[model samples]
Target chain A: MNNALPRWVDYGLMPLISVIVAFVISGLVVLFVGESPVQAALLMAKGAFGSGYNIGFTLFYATTFIFTGLAVAVAFHAGLFNIGGEGQAYVGGLGVALVCLSLDSVFPWWITFPFAIIAGALFGALWAFIPAILQAKRGSHIVITTIMFNFIASALMVYLLAGPLQKSANLGPRSRDFAEGGQIPKLGGLFRPLGIDMGASPLNVSFALALIMALVVWIIIWRTRFGYEMRTLGISPRAARYAGMSEVRLVVLAMMLSGALAGMMALNPVMGDQARLQLDFVEGAGFVGIAVALMGRSHPAGIVPAAILFGGLYQGGSELAFDMPNITRDMIVLIQGLVILFAGAMGSLFTPAIVRLLTGVGVMPK
Target chain B: METILQLLDLTVRSAVPLLLACLAGLYSERSGIVDIGLEGKMLGGAFAAAAAAAVTGSVWLGLLAGIFVSVLLALVHGFASITNKGNQIVSGVAINFIAAGAAALLGNAWFNQGGRTPQLQSEQRFNPIELPLAETLSSVPVLGPTYQQLISGHNLIAYFAFAMVPITWWVLFRTRFGLRLRAVGENPAAVDTAGISVSWARYRAVICCGILCGIAGAYLSIGVSAGFVKDMTAGRGFIALAALIFAKWRPVSAMWACLLFGFLGAIEIRYQGVALPVLGVVPVQLMQALPYILTVVLLAGFIGKAIPPRAGGVPYTKER
Candidate 1:
């Protein structure tokens, strides 16, 4: 029970359990529709990673998730739920798009790219700053505020994309494609010599950028003084204040950083991947960030693998229904849901035993 | 004058589902567990009601099925947060995600319209009530036409939603059960001292919350519209949660807040294509976001502070 290996096993158990649960649930679904669950699962696996293109595409999707998961994880560690990551990411995408479209004629790709990223980050930070300021000053719960902000941002994006920023060639609610100079150069062709063709895959320099950012985030959280203050504030605001930390500034900073990381998710997709903005384009990554946060347990190091797992599901699930008509991509979402449920119900697994054993030991006095 | 009356009628119909959902949140949060998953439960109930109605061709049976399904979800939520001592917010999120995917999966499989149900005929749907006596009252004066058209023209659920305000007030303030429920939320240890079961009170409150959410969903799918669509509830549930906070978790106040949000929704949807010179073609999307923006602002400032029950989310473990 006290072994480190067993502790690691416990940590690894939930993801494996969730996949099994998902398979069982999907099996039931297949049974209802008169299909073999194993065949459906096999089809799903093949659809996900059958080709080099599939692997590239899956990694591409994971790259965006990495940014979002890190965003949620960072904010969660600060004891704040950053559900507004969706809205922030949307705004961040807009910021990056606007910068790319406007500056393509004047600046080179190298200069414009970093500027776009900074612009995205600032916009995201400002978006998050609203809720942080309100929570710190007026004691408004962040949960409600962040959720409300999400709606506002979604609406704002729809309006912008449908009207002011609508692409001239496109008749829908989407922005114009970025200038040629602004597009991320493909590394897939470079990898083609090794039998990898990354055509139509959104992954590029952004995936590496995301991993590096994750490492930087881990350092900031575990080593920096600001992170110490944020963690302390997360645990107990009163204690932090007594320890001479500014609670208001730390709270605002935490949210701003959270939003900034979220902004990078947009950067990964829009600049290094999609090169265009569409309505509901992020496809609820903001809300899904909550799951990633829970699954990762708010640890930056933990979030990398967690994000990749989700990324694989996204990659695999999309192709499931195509290969196997009975098993839909929705199974991925359901499995994610099951993982969240198991993770959330973690207390039920051991609370009774822990309490009884502790009470028996006289640790909890009668 | 007639235009104004029509708008008022629209407001009432639009507000009914939101009002009911807000009332549901009022019950759950007042008992001390944050019900962010109300959106999911409402959506689940809506899908269940629509599917049930489509299968059985009976509105009444569909409504019951909807409530039953929603209550089951709330039970799951209660079990996790109340019994397992898990984080209430996280558990609520889990319920929402599960409901979203599960309902969509089932809906797609059964209906084959990508999580949407087939529209029902007039006989299969809930019919709005028409009062013959209100015909004579339409010409009396300024109030007569308003009353006849706005108040008397809604379907049964609209009236039920309006009636629920006073009923909720009476149940929460007048009844002994309400007192014990509130007691359990505020201080479960004290309720335990008083020989009342905290767990039972909370469980019952959550069940009531589910029933109310079910009614809200039924109103959305059947009473307001003819069929269920993916995420048809949109963010109405969150607005309901906001209304709960705005009303300080008081049922009557929640009613007014819901009406306000419903009015905004009605205006946005009704006036989408109309070009106002002053507002410069107000996009439907911008108007759709008005309620959320308003909620954030109110929660941050004008509503002042609404405190939750101190022991709301904590699981009540009996000490032997």
Candidate 2:
């Protein structure tokens, strides 16, 4: 069989096909739950794109997904799977909360935001450091260690939130609200000056920050010397060694960078939206990152669109649940799971058949 | 003394599911398929068992249904990893997500109780069975009371969990199927060349894994508690995987490791508000995190090296 298909077919067409298959399967699931799949689809599209408010919420979710998707993509480039993005984001939220609580009264929003970002990145990097070092030096697998850390991070967060961080006046397991100066301005306000009513949504300056981070990731991965070494290590560790690249250093650096990107995800939820630290702010965005990275083929250009698509699914799924009583939130999760299963695990299921067709048509170089 | 015995009982109670799941993982991973989907299978089983028992009012039927669903999931994993040559971990993660979502969706739709199945009646649940001579033995000294508290008065599944350790060891070491399974994990090509179909060996191993995980799930819903809860497995499957590694993939050692984790779990529950002598008010969260922390420490080679099967996680292709 000819294996000389164009890059677009390999990267673009395959993911598109997988996603369509997944949606068909999900539509069947919706039908199983006694709902009209067509109506659900229409409702979802409208919910995700109908009004400025809906679009704003979608962008807000997309922002977080972008950060996390980039996190997974960066690590994948180095041949590492960083499943601990959830934990890193959780700890990074803690970092943001700490910085906000301590400096909110003294510093302005601009001053505190940078400190919060640094702290979030540092804490996230620290969380990833142990697994990175283990993988680099001890030959221990990164997947297991990162998974364990996720659980540990949850427990630690529970402890902090319920014990020390809980407000004196409140009994809930959440930190007190941030000072006015520390809260990032919502994008809704920015749009007011342009005579466009974006409505009430969590969309904020962090969305722009997330885009900037994606650009930075692209430059670092494609242009920088460190990224070249990291890619070399991923492609062939022996070849990298022969070329005098330090595998250990590259592994650690790649993981730390991945964790930092994941940490930045907390900024959107905690600082930009919640204006306070809360349990489970990260939700399953970390896990969703894996699917986004897979569907995007681990490229920033691909991840941006993939993240937006997922964000639409999430926002629209909620609307479907609200409109249709039979379809619950869990049903939405089931659909997301099906999508992940197809796009990530069964991603190459149609590759061989497509290759055969493309070669038979003489579209590929034989 | 009584507190110690009660703690021991709680440890046994908690250890049963972990023991079963860890042994299940041992079967699949021993044959070269990394079964990280143990959690998902267990969740699927728990939901099936709970739903079936609620409708049928028969725990035995529920157990069968649970096993059926779990085996179906196992077949899905096998098809993806073995036939499609997909990434095992990704497949497992997907399975976890599917189980979590499907359980909630079905539970709410069927029962209309917000993603939770109806609570099982006494007749539909596994109740503790008192052993013969337990009343007479309770009057005796240490051994009798110890046996009465720790051994005699538990559900049937606990005994099955304990028995499975030796049974697994015997099957893996003494049986022909066991030899082929281990050989396939270490080197599938060599096993294939020896006229043993590697896929068949792996399929059998994964199926066995499903059965074990199904029992673990059933035990959680019908035996341990009354009905299913969302995310009830609650990362126990991952802990079981950790136990599998901690035991170096050995059955007997896996039991011991699971027991240790169970003890930790029991301690966390029993000493929620108690202050210890040296530690002074040991936080429940810290205790909850201990098992994972220890797993990380072990994986980092702080305890000992855990070398996986040589051919593990690599899809076997004949042409390659």
Model 1 per-residue lDDT tens digits across residues A1-366 = 213223443455544555465558657866786677777767666765778788787778777888888888888778887878998998888888888889876777788888887988888888999999999998888978988888888889988888899976446888777777577665577678998776767678778878888898888888999888889988887899899998889889989999988887887778776678777777877766776766676776667777877787788888877765545666666666666776655435543554566568876544
Residue pairs that clash (backbone atoms under 3 angstroms), model 2: none
TM-scores computed on chain B for all candidates: 0.94, 0.99
Give the DockQ (2 decimals) of all models: 0.65, 0.79
Best by lDDT: 2
Q: Which prediction has the highest TM-score against the true structure?
A: 2
Instruction: Give the backbone clash total of model 2.
Output: 0
lDDT of model 2 at position A349 = 81
Worst ten-residue run, lDDT, model 2 chain A? A1-10
Per-residue lDDT over B1-320 for candidate 1, one digit per residue giving the tens place of the 0 to 100 score: 88777776777777888889888887787677778889888988998999899999999988998899899989988888887667788778777877777777778877788778999877667778877768888888987787788877788888888899999989988999888878888888888998888878888989999999988898888887998998888877888887787777888888888888778777886787798778777779877887887777777777576776777667777889
- Model 2 TM-score on a 0 to 1 scale: 0.97
**How accurately is candidate 1 docked according to DockQ?**
0.65
Candidate 2 lDDT over A4-108, as tens digits, reads 657898678988988898788778877887789899899999888787888889889999999999999999999898999999999989988899999999988
